[model samples]
Target: MATSAPLLGKAAHSKASIFYGADEYLEELKKRYAHDHEIAALKNALPGEGDPNAAGVAQSNDKMLSVQKNNENRSLKTNRLFPTPNKPDPMPQNLAFLFTKITPEQMIYMWNVLTAIFCSQVLMVIGYCAALATFPDYWWTCTLCFGVPFSYIAIQNIYIDHDVMHGATFPVYEWQRFLTHPFADFFSLPWEEFVLEHNRHHASTVDLLIQGEFGWDPEEFHYALQQWAGPWSSNWYKYLLTVPFIPVIHFFGLNDTGSLFALEWWMHFPDEGAGGKCNKEFWSKWIPRRIKHNAFVLSLWACIWLLGTYPLGRPLSEGWRFMFTVSFFARIGYSAAWMFITNFTHSF
Candidate 1:
C-alpha cells in the first residue's frame, strides 16, 4: 500500500505539469493574437504609411482627380468617330471607337477568311499552270490540285457571305459591300438574290414552307417535288432519287423552275400578276444582273485559262476541259456538303 501511494503521487504530479504547460501555451497564444490585432489596426489607420503623399492626402486626392480627367479626355478623343448610345455602356473597355483600323480580336476572327482567300488564289494560279502543262496525262492529279482548293474557297466564301449578310463581321458596311460582288461571283450566287433570300429567311423564320431559305415545310417539299417531277411521282422514292441531283441542280441555278420562269414573265409583262408563280419582281431584277455577273465570271476564268495554256503551247480545248472538270467537282462537292450540313442542323 505504501509503494502504491508513491506511484499515485507521481501520476498526480505529471497531470499538474501538463495542465500548467497548457495554461502557459494558451497565454502565449493570446499575447500573439493581441499583438497581431494591434499591427492590423495600425495598418488600417495608416493605409499610405510608406507613400510620399502620406503627409499630403488632399494633394493625392487632387492628383487622382487630374488623372481621371485626363482619361476622360482621351476617351472623348477616341470616341469622336463612333458616338456611344444613351444607355449605360456594358463594355467600357472595349475598343469600339477604332473604326479605321482592325483590333486584335477582329484580326483573329478574319484570319481564316483571309488565309483561305489568299491560298485559293495561289492554288488556282498553280492549278491553271499545272493543268495546261500536264492535264491530259495527269488529269486526276490536276483535278485534285484544282478542285480541293476551289471547293475550300467556295465554302469559305459562303461563310463570309453569310457573315456579311448577317452583319457579323467588322462593322464597316462599305468594306463588306466592296467584297460582296467578288464573293458572289466566285460562289455563283448573286448578292441581291442572296440578300433577298437571307432577309426573307430572317423575317419568316417561323414559316417552314418558304423555299430554299429557312425551314423546309413537308407540304412545300411535296409541292416542289410534285412540280419538278409531276404530281403522280411525289413520293419518298422520288425524293431520294432527287437528292443525288440537288448539288448539280443548285450549281447550275436550276433548282427552282417556277422561280426562273417567273423572271421571264415579269420582264415581258411587268403589269401581269405572277399567278401561282414565284415572286416576279424579285426574279426579274435578279435574272438580268445574274446573267451579267455570271458572264463576267466565265470571261474571267476563260482569260485565266487562255493566259495559262496559250503561252505554254497547250491546247485551249484541254484548258477548257480541265477547268470545267475542276469547276464541276468543286461546285458539286461544296454544294452537297453544305446542303447535308444545313439539312442536318436545320436551324437558321
Candidate 2:
C-alpha cells in the first residue's frame, strides 16, 4: 500500500493495485497482458526446448524474428522477377503456330529420312569411287572422280533425304522402305545418339543464327575463315581470290595447318571410334581381331614408301605410283565436291 503510488504511476492499472479513475489505463493494461500471454504460448509450442529463462527467451525470439525477415526478403525478390500468376503471360504468335504444326508422325518420318540419307551417302561414296576406278581414260575421270561423290550426295538428298526430313517418305509406301535402307547404308549410325543430338539442333534452327553447316557442323570452318575475314575483310578482290583455296583447304584438309600433323599421326593408326571417346566398347578395341587391321594397313603403307626409290625395283615403284595418283587424287576430289554440294543446299 505504501508503494502503490509509484507502481500505479508506471503501470497505471495492475490487478493487485488498480488506479480507480483511469479507465483508459485499465484497457491498455488488459491488451498488453493479452499480447504477452500469446507470445509466451507461442514460445512454449515451438519445437525446441526453448529457454524458460529471460536470456533464452530473448535468443529464441531473435531467431524467429530473423527467419521471418529472411522469408519476407525472398518473397519480395521472387515477386519482382515473376509476377503473381493472375496476369496473362505473353508469347510470340508465330512460334506458337510453328509448334502447333509439328506432330509425332511428322517427327517419325523426318527420322526415317535422315537415317536413310546418312547410310546411303556412305555407300554412295564407296560406290562412286569404285565406278571411277573402272574408267581409266575418262578425261572427266579427274572431274568425275570428284564430281561423282557430290552428285551422289545431291541425288540422295533430292530422291531420299529431303522427303525423309519432311517426314513424307514413310514405309507406308513400299518405295520408301526400299530406297532408304540397304541403298542408303542403314546401319552406319548409332541411331539413338544421333537422333537426340540432331533433334536438339533442329529445335534451335533459325536462318543464320544457329542453323548448322548443312548437316555438318559450321564450327569446322570457323578458324579457317578467320584469317581471311581478318585483315583481308576490307580488301574485296583479295577475299574473292582466296575463295578457291577455301574449299580446297576445308574439304581436303590441306590448309588444316595444325590438323595436318594430327591427320598424319591418325593415318599411322586408323580411327575405329566414329569421332567419340576411345573406350573398351568402341570398335578400336576389336581392331586387332581383324587380319587386315592396323598392322596390315601400316605394312602396306611401308611397302609404298620402300617402293618409291627411282632406280631400285621399278615395277613396284611404277605400280604404287599409279595406284596412289589415281586413288589418292580421286579421294581428294570426291571429298571436296561432296562438301561443296552440302554447303550449297544449306547456306543462305
Candidate 3:
C-alpha cells in the first residue's frame, strides 16, 4: 500500500486520473467506498478517536485516517495550486460580485463588511431571542425568530469563510485564526479543523482521496465523514449534548481522546474532544490548546452574561440559565440548519 508522492501536474491532482485507465472504475470505487462505510459500522464507531492513539499514529501517506497523523512532516505545507483567473468571466450584477477579488483593499473591505453583517445578524438573533424569552407566550415564536435569520446568515457566512479558508481573503493562513474568535466560535464550528476538512472535500470532491496530510483513504477517513455528516449519520444526542458541552467537559472529570495529528497550520478540534487530564500529555503537547479555546469561549459567555443582565435586562437572579437558554436556541438553529442542509440539500 505504499504509494508514491503525487506528481507536479493536473494529472497528479485529478482524482479521476487515479482510475482513468478503466471504464466503470469510479462506479466500482463508489461501491467499495460505500462498503467501507457499511463495514465501519456507525453503530459501534467511536466518535472522537478518528485517528490512531498517540502510540500508534500513522505517518505514511498510504493509510488514510480521518485525522491523518502526518507527524513526519508537520512543518512542511501541503497545498494544491489553484488556477489564478487571468480574465475571469464577468459576474452578473449580484451580491456575489463582491466575493470576486480585484485588489487586496477590496478583498479586506468586503470580508470586513461580511464579518460585520455576520456578527450583527448573530447578535440580533441573540438579543431578540433573549428579549422574547421574557414573554412566556412567545417561546415557540422565539424559535422561528432565531431559526430563520440565523440559518440564512450562517449559510451565507459558510460561503464567505469557505473562500477565506482557501486563502482568497488572507495571504497568510494563520491569520485566518481570528475568523473564529466570536462568529465561528458562536456557531461551534472551529475555523482550523473546518478549513482543513473542508478543503479536502473540494480537493477530491469526486472520490475524496487527496494525498499528503489529510490521509485520503476511505477506510480510515470514514469517521471524519461521519462526524461531518453530523446528526444525519452520527449519533444525534452525541451531537446535541456533547457538542455544546465541550467547554464544560474538562470541568468535570470526563474527556474524549482527540485526533493525535499535530500541525502548526491547522489549529482547532471542536469535534475531536480535546480536554481533561486523561489526555493531558497526549497529542505531542498540542491538545492542551483546546483548554485555551474553551477558556476563551467561556470568557465570551461571560461577556454574554454582562450583555444579558444589563442591556438585555435579565434579572440578576436568572444567573447563567437565561444566557444558556439563548445560546441553546442559537445552537439548535445551527444544528437544524446543518442537518437540513446535509440531509436534504443534495441528491446522493
Clashes of each: 0, 3, 0
Q: Each candidate's lDDT (Cα)? A: 0.40, 0.35, 0.38
Candidate 1 structure quality by residue, lDDT tens digits, 202-315: 322222323322221212332353235544345556666665654544465332112232243224322233464553543655466567655656665676557555655767
- List the lowest-lDDT window of 10 residues for candidate 1: 60-69
Ranked candidates, highest TM-score first: 1, 3, 2
Off by over 4 Å in 3: 1-106, 129-147, 167-176, 179-190, 208-214, 217-294, 310-317, 336-347
Q: Find the candidate with the highest lDDT and give its number.
A: 1
118-163, model 3: which lDDT tens digit per residue?
Answer: 4676577566646565764776676567656765565565555645
Displacement of residue 195 (Cα, Å) in model 2 is 7.7
Indicate the worst ten consecutive residues by lDDT in candidate 2: 184-193
Lowest summed lDDT window (length 10), candidate 3: 250-259
Model 2, residue 212: displacement in angstroms? 14
lDDT over C-alpha atoms for residue 57 of model 2: 29
Q: Estimate each model's TM-score.
A: 0.46, 0.31, 0.43
What are the RMSDs of all candidates, in order? 28.8, 30.6, 17.4
Clashing pairs in 2: 113-164, 119-184, 120-184
